[model samples]
Target: MTMRSRLTTNRLFLSPFTLDDVDELHAILADPRTNTIGSGPFTAIAQTEKWIRNRMAAERDHGLRWYAVRQKATDVLIGNCGLFRGRADAEIGYLIHRPWQGRGFASEAVAAVLDECRSAGIGPVWAIIRPHNTFSIRIAERAGLRLARIESDERGPLHYFVTSRANT
Candidate 1:
């Protein structure tokens, strides 16, 4: 199924990423608080550029793309949310800038994406979150993904959350 390029919520908007987003996206990704659970913060603009290019290619080749999350009123980018092909099912993930955290933006964006997933007939979506990221874990649970197991990879332990058949 073809996913829409834009999604909206009461206070936020989600659109596909473009190279033009590099500067703002780089700032967000470079923030230590935002990258605490993942690889360390990005150190260069080229990294962010490459990131956008890769996601754009993924959208073209795999039908999976990351959305640039922005505030509707201000039209300022604050984070991102998207789905990725996973080992068993599509996986969902999101990140909100520290300045925008605790304001429910991440949760809102995730819920909107989950609704999109449902409409697209993508079921049993997974959320692979670092065990220490309690904030993300809470968002995953609130989005109706229950913990199925904990798995480890090169990145260490990760909590695997999946949408229930009934929920999806």
Candidate 2:
């Protein structure tokens, strides 16, 4: 079995992704409505499997990657959230299933991951949200990230929010 920290909050538990979670992961990623501006609602199960495999590899190599978030009472997988090594720092990201959106789950997951980052001695994580993704912007802010700037990419403008430790 894969070894990882199991993080808990009042309402949810966070565990690292494993191959066993592909089905749940696929269910969450299959809805196109969940695919916001710059990411995916995976086109196929195989694609989702590839994503899980990649995350597994990231855990093996870097000891950090997205996690599976589930409801504490039912253990039903509801989302994934975490950080990855970015060009300049750790980049935070998350996704909650369509049914779970707007319930504060994403913010809870993000806050847990931020605590993990602090414990791991990682600093200055950043969240890149597409402009108009107000829900995500709110989650990031509530999780203690502050907007630093907006930058345009091939996909258009993205709002960059960094941890309180990062300078504006």
Candidate 3:
């Protein structure tokens, strides 16, 4: 297994996306609720598979890996969390399955991703969220990121949060 597949937290394990995980990822991302904060819901399995392939390529080429977060006890894939090559800088992103929400899984997974970013010497990780996504904003804050600014776009307003420079 690759190093990207070995990240672990107290109750979770995080691994890089693989083609074999397409079905689980599709199940997680297919929900309209999951995408309401950012991209729209994925309607096809091909889109999820392509996304997984892109994540692998990002890790191979850009050193950015979106990890699949799983429960350590049952070893079930629960969601994905990690940094992606964003338009400006490395963006810290995460998604937990609908069934996994409200159980602190998102925060734990995000905390792990932030730890990985800091360990990798990547400073000032960014997290973009919709202004109304208060839950995610709280998760980002708890993960050691501070609100940087809010910007408006065609779609709507977005809240941009960044890790404190002291973390560098």
Candidate 4:
């Protein structure tokens, strides 16, 4: 929430995180599908708010950029999507609300974010995809990212992607 987002798209808009968005954030991150790759869920909405606030504080403390993804038509937030801990290269991460999944929203917003980053001179946007997350892997490939590695973690193997700014 330190800086405003300059990115927007036809179906979605990306803006800096706001503490007021706790409810919507909870709606998305608490879903089973969303949590499939996250830390866990918050039984209390207040806890989600705490987490969001903590993320903002952490971003400020660590000098990172975070953005909130919202539906343009409804002005309803779908989830958080951003280049985590920014650099000339960044890690692309997104999670769609369960009801909104499988509708290309993730691909659309992610593509939009990628284009935004490239235009801002952030080259070679990167993402670490969970090995079993075929959906995200396909989405990244469709957006022109090339798999760079199959990494091992405590969970298991995961794929890493890096997009070419020249092709963007």
Of 1 and 4, which scores higher on TM-score?
A: 1
Q: Model 2: per-residue lDDT, tens digit, 1-168? A: 122478888899998888889888888788888865446678788988888888777777776767899999999999899766654467888989888898899989988888878777777789988878888889998988888898887778888888886422
lDDT of 1 by residue, 26-136 (tens): 999999978665567999999999988888887787777679999999999999998876656478879899999999999999999988888877777899888888989
| Top lDDT prediction, candidate number | 1
In angstroms, give how far residue 130 of model 1 lies from its true place. 1.6
Q: State the lDDT of candidate 3 residue by residue for 95-152, as single tens digits.
A: 8877888999999998887777777787678989888888889999888888888888
Please name the candidate that would achieve the greatest TM-score relative to the true structure.
Answer: 1
Off by over 4 Å in 3: 1-4
| Ranking of all predicted structures according to TM-score, beginning with the best and ending with the worst | 1, 3, 2, 4
Which pairs of residues have clashing backbones in candidate 2? none
RMSD of every candidate to native, in Å, equals 1.4, 3.0, 2.1, 3.1
lDDT head-to-head 1 vs 4, winner: 1
What TM-score does prediction 2 earn?
0.90
Arrange candidates, best lDDT first. Answer: 1, 3, 2, 4
> In candidate 1, which residue pairs clash?
none
Q: TM per model?
A: 0.94, 0.90, 0.93, 0.84
Off by over 4 Å in 2: 1-4, 37-39, 166-168
lDDT, model 2, position 76: 98
In candidate 4, what are the lDDT values of residues 31-109, reduced to their tens digit?
7667677577667888788868766775677534567878889988887777665323457788788777888888888
Taking all chains together, the TM-score of candidate 3 against the true structure is 0.93
lDDT, candidates in the order shown: 0.88, 0.81, 0.83, 0.74
Error of 2 at 99 (Å): 0.7
Please list the residue runs of candidate 4 whose C-alpha ends up more than 4 Å from where it truly belongs after superposition: 1-4, 57-64, 86-89, 165-168
